[model samples]
Target: MFINVSDESITVNNKWERAELAQIEEISMYPVALIGDVLQRLGMMASVIRHVAGKATFFGTVLPILTWEGDNLAIHRALDDAQPGDVLVINGNGEINRALFGDLLGEVCLARKVAAVVIDGAVRDIQELDAMGLPTYARAVNPAGPSKYGPGQVGFPVACGHIVCNPGDAIFGDRDGIIVIDRRLVSSLAAKLKLQDDVENNFRARVRASLG
Candidate 1:
């Protein structure tokens, strides 16, 4: 269920299922690189989208926002529907000339308990965002600001960082980059992630023993 407010140039989808808290917690134990390995490296976002500020890792259900190039009016509107465990995944059309997110929005996200933010564009205020410790990543950084005039959509599928992201999808991000997982796959992938993690841990233990 979604609402299209033509006058406002925004569309909001009101219905999507979030994964269980336990499931999200279970998956968060693994690194983003390990999860990508388990997924056969299919869901990893482009490397150009690097961690810019805040914590290095975060995991949450996705709240996808698609905005016009270099504009972020949709993001402001999307926050009205944001939940604590939600991650704001914005597809800013890969525009890096203007920052679509910054410290002000970072504060808002902190207050709302947003799990993380990944922008397929640009963001600014790196120092404040880092101090605030909200996990944030983007394609680039520019001090220039963004336009509020929106022709955008929220809760819709967005192509962020060269990968398609659907609302309610599970997102895990780290220093390497972001990965999108389907909500339906969380349970099944959780087991695979554990198995792979165990394999890597054993390998590391073996290497340490050899070194000793």
Candidate 2:
């Protein structure tokens, strides 16, 4: 059940089911690194995609957008379909020369109640973004703004940070980096994540006792 809009330039798929809110909330309690461990270290985005501004933690269903390098028309269209808990996962072809997001878009996202933003490219307006408190991550920062031309895709699968991101996939990020979890795997990973957290907590406690 996907809506496809095709033209000479841009394409969009407007339909995908989000993970249950309860499931998303439950997974949010675990650390992103621990979740990656439970996924056998296969779901993490590349370390190059670091936290660039705002809060360091965010988790929500992905809304993937693919845009031409140095262009951002598709990003604007994607927002039209955005839901309250979406994380805009943009694949800007890893182009660091031009920023694909900034403070004005951040304001729109906040108004829309978007959870966060992850870009495999660049972003600008760091001070404004940080003040706005929208969790944002990117490969770099550039003062160069993006062109608004088309030839992009929205609500489709995109390769970002060397990992494939699909709309409706659960994405989590913190200081460590970003990780994607398939919607189907969300429920199954909860117990494993909890157990690993407990183990790590106990190990840290033992190290503290030795020091004492």
Q: Rate the local accuracy (lDDT) of all candidates.
A: 0.89, 0.89
CA error at residue 40 for candidate 2, angstroms? 0.8
After best superposition, candidate 1 residue 50: deviation in angstroms? 0.5
Candidates in order, TM-scores: namely 0.93, 0.92
> Which regions in candidate 1 have their CA more than 4 angstroms from the true location?
1-7
lDDT of 2 by residue, 6-43 (tens): 33477888878887768888998888878888889988
After superposition, candidate 2 runs with Cα above 4 Å error: 1-8, 210-212
TM-score of 1: 0.93
lDDT of 1 by residue, 24-46 (tens): 87899888889999999988999
